[model samples]
Target: MKWHHVQDNWPAFFEAILDRWPDADEAELEEIDGDQRAFIAYVIELTGQEPEEARADIREWLSGELPSDVVMDPRHDNHSIALSKKYVPEGEDEYDDDSRFGDEE
Candidate 1:
């Protein structure tokens, strides 16, 4: 499947990928230009796991069995964040006045 498809179907796994390669320097992690083998290799290095183990782990995580200790970075999980914001009740401000959201005043 395409990378975006994978990201949509397996968001946690995508989040893990983005956690490893932040968008600050790499703009588009979704548009990774290569074969699955290369991507698998990258995943192995990123997660510090054996090839077979990493693949199996990723599969499990994608299937909604994410480990309790696997914390997803908000900076990378934009889809989930956006969804939360979209569904948040009116008058309930979840975010602080951070520069990341632009001018506070």
Candidate 2:
């Protein structure tokens, strides 16, 4: 997906991806989701955070750079969860490369 799509759908998309793997980062995600981490990075960009901000946050928290309470707060504005259910319809094509979405290239 394009970065514009990620900007529009960041909240929901990120939430879904993170829910599947709360500790995921670009490299780890690249193995699991292929090119789709571009979308995840795009979501972080839309937040005005760096590509690795989320991953760094996870790492720092794990290393005690930040308090556990700060890290574990559910109130953190992960917009992905809220937007996820609305952007793509049930059974709709999400993968730009999906044969179901027609030939992408």
Candidate 3:
């Protein structure tokens, strides 16, 4: 299908889903709407920028602004702490299992 056709028919998405499950709560509907808007806005934003500019801007923004720490829910067995320890170690690749590399070749 053409791009314009897909864009034009986008509004029908809400009706089709809602028609299937009309009893969905207000919060659920709002979430669906918010996701749709965010996706569409992302597509629009990225459509025109050059790849280099987009990548550099995104990298700079993420590196300079995003926090290194995250708040974890203490209810869980602190899975976040465990995952972070493995993925983002105090030293690089500390938790990585290098044994898998020998099998790949």
Candidate 4:
């Protein structure tokens, strides 16, 4: 989905995946978080799809028939780096980056 769509629906999407894989351990949960972020980045950078189209794509991908493996190699891809940078707020401490998402300090 688009960046905003993913940002808005991330909690639901994350919960759904967790429900599907209730046996996931701590490391698996961390991997899931990374995968979800990578999926958001992929949809924004590669597809350029609007919210509806991106949501449909996400639903299809989450259907379990295909792998949900999104390559998150931002270090090598300028487009990925640009997309990621768009979410980084200016004048924010790198360690406090969660504030961009409205997390409290």
Output the number of the TM-score-best candidate: 1
Full ranking by lDDT: 1, 4, 2, 3
- Candidates' C-alpha lDDT: 0.53, 0.45, 0.42, 0.50
Residue 87 alpha-carbon offset, candidate 1, angstroms: 15
Q: Tell me which residue pairs clash in candidate 2.
A: 11-79, 11-80, 12-80, 12-84
Native-vs-model 2 lDDT?
Answer: 0.45
Cα TM-score of candidate 3: 0.23
Candidate 3 stretches with Cα past 4 Å from truth are 1-47, 67-69, 73-105
Write one digit per residue (lDDT tens) for candidate 3, span 1-105.
Answer: 222332344443344334433543444444445354443344235445565554454334324311222222473335444566656746765445557769444
What is the C-alpha RMSD, rounded to one decimal, of candidate 2? Answer: 17.1
Candidate with maximal lDDT? 1
TM-score, structure 2 vs. true: 0.21
Per-residue lDDT of 73 in model 2: 38
Expressed as tens digits, the lDDT of each residue in 1-105 for candidate 2 is 333333444343444456544555545444434344554464465445676785564334334222222223354324434445467778754432445546553
Better of 2 and 3 by lDDT: 2
Candidate 3 Cα deviation (angstroms), residue 80: 17
